[model samples]
Target: MTLLAGRRVLLVEDESLVAMLAEDMLLDLGCEVVVAMRLDKALAQARTGSFDLAVLDVNLGDTRSYPVADLLFERGTPFLFATGYGRQGLEEAYKAVPVLQKPYQAAPLKHLLTRLLMGEPPTREGTGGGPMPCGCHISREQQPFQVDHCS
Candidate 1:
């Protein structure tokens, strides 16, 4: 079985099609998936749900999913952003989080989640508390989020 087998994952995406596609990918990876299509619903889940990981959409139509990210952060839950804009879309406060560039493919998604679930340090690319490609710096005081492993 894959590392993702039997894991519980929270997937927050505003678009129905994208959600379905991601859910299918996760299911194929043998994960138990929980889906949230709105900010409020995602918040509620993030606040109380027991999940091994979460994939959050940076944009949720009229709102952003940063609040959900904050909640997950406080809980020490590992999550990554899924966006078409790549890392460029993230705000300064969240630049360190791993991002899954959109048009989500099954292969890269599996690779990232597997690496994360295995307790490997997230590949931060150029955002390792250094200046981004855009010449913006991420604060060292902002601790990187950790992924909790399932027993």
Candidate 2:
């Protein structure tokens, strides 16, 4: 919570309900979250300032977030991808960045986000997009999570 207290975050998700819920979660965690429903809007915002980090969906409205990820990478802004598509859905280059799967409980998500912001490498296969390396929270009893909320 304290990790993101004053950090600036850009949230990019096409689905309205999921976007709103994520926004609420960011607020609950005390991070300043900006909502961007599309790639263009989020890119425009990215041009304005150096955001501390970002939470993006792998796919937007007919567009992919990989380009945005490149932009964020160039700017040294660390980001996590929130995708309903699960791990196999991820592109090769981005399999290394952190992933936070859909339907996460607030506390686990918060912990993951905090660790991410602090620059910790992941230890377990994230239910969505993280490389199992640095000791992260992975669900032992479950297969990967899938979120079709947007579908």
Top candidate on lDDT is 1
TM-score of 2: 0.77
Q: What TM-scores do the predictions have?
A: 0.79, 0.77
* Model 1 lDDT tens row, 20-119: 9999999999999999999999999999899889999999999999999888867767777888887778887777677777877786677667756655
Q: Write the per-residue lDDT of candidate 2 for residues 58-107, one digit (tens) a residue.
A: 88978898877878766768777887666667777777777777754466
Instruction: For each candidate in the order shown, give its overall lDDT on alpha carbons.
Output: 0.77, 0.70
> Candidate 2, 151: how far from true, in Å?
31
State the weakest 10-residue window (summed lDDT) of model 2: 142-151
Model 1's number of clashes is 0
Model 1 residue 134 CA deviation in Å: 22
- Candidate 2 regions with alpha-carbon error over 4 angstroms: 120-151
